[model samples]
Target: MATVLVIGASRGIGLELVRQYRAAGDRVIATARDDEGMTRLRELGAEPLRIDVAQPASVSGLAWQLDGEEIDVALYVAGVIDRGHATTPPTQSAFDHVMHTNVLGLMQVLPQVMPMVEATGGVFGALSSSMSQIGPVPGSNSWLYRVSKAALNMAVRSARFDYPKARLVVLDPGWVQTDMGGESAPVTVEDSVYGLRRVLASLGADDNGCLIHHDGRRAASW
Candidate 1:
């Protein structure tokens, strides 16, 4: 079975992914910001880790804790969506918030995690969003989210080229019913994770640097 590391495994899509992977007998290492959040993952058979993705030292500390263990998959799910009117404080704060986790936090983990993933010939995934499209938004009110995710896609692309040996995947989890997405969203966490995990399980090295979606289709545009 594959050994997997799931970032942001506290709840919603991340938690479901952890559960499915563990149920399939994968040795799962899951991380979140706090003990309370990690407890659910613990009950689901994943080794829950306290990881604050926005902190560079926290990531390095985690690498130290693992002690050179090789992982078959490393999925970075830690991110934030800043909902605002594309105006003052809220948008500004949103930009900073999203960058701190989605971009800066990713940078911290990517350098360390990508090297380990390449060493083990593992799959490295980063959660991206269609809202990041340079084209136009399907809906309003997610301007900050759109910008941050677009930047994230670029970051993932860079990692793809940098880590040629690993299956570097940039994935859109779809508008799932989660805390960030709201209850009215069409897809469920289980549905999105089910498709995503399937893609992860089956991806080949040739698929590296690809942008894919929760439904197993290649996402169009950057």
Candidate 2:
């Protein structure tokens, strides 16, 4: 069993990941901003902590709390989808909110967790999306959300250069049925998480810096 750290384990994919990891006998350290989610995590035998990814202080507190412990897997599953881009000019508040939480927030949290993963020679993964791809362009809606995810992909790439020994991956969980993916999404949380676990378990230094699909497929482009 490995020691796993899951960020944004409040609900959906994050919540399911916590459950699956615990069920597999891995030690899970989960974080969530909401009370209900934290309670659920505790019920699953995970040590849940309070964290608002948008707030740097909260993330710092978590890092300080963990201190020198080695983490086997650190998965960043926190993100937001702002449909405000569907508007004519797009709402500035909504745009800023997504960028802060999805981009800047990740930038801040990675530093605190990377060392822990490095100590254990483990993997560090970021939850990305297929929509973040530039070439095979999808619909034009949610443009801002797409941009934020694209930026996040780059951030993970940059991390690979710094943590040479650590296996770092950008995971695309497919279009799953969740609060962010919506009811129309074809994949279920169980299916996505199961595939993701397989993909993650198979990662190696050769797979570092690659964008991987939940089913273990790899992509060259971000």
Please report, in order, the local distance difference test score of every candidate based on alpha carbons. 0.82, 0.88
Cα lDDT for residue 71, candidate 2? 95
Please provide, for model 1 over 79-107, each residue's C-alpha lDDT reduced to its tens digit, 9 standing for 90 to 100. 88877655545545556767888888887
TM-score of each: 0.92, 0.95
Q: Highest TM-score among the candidates is held by which one? A: 2
RMSD (Cα, Å) of candidate 1? 1.8
* Backbone steric clashes in candidate 1, count: 0
Q: Which residue segments of model 2 deviate by more than 4 Å?
A: 84-87
Strongest candidate by lDDT: 2
Residue 137, model 1: lDDT of 69
- Which residue pairs show backbone clashes in model 2? none
Candidate 2 least-lDDT 10 residues = 82-91
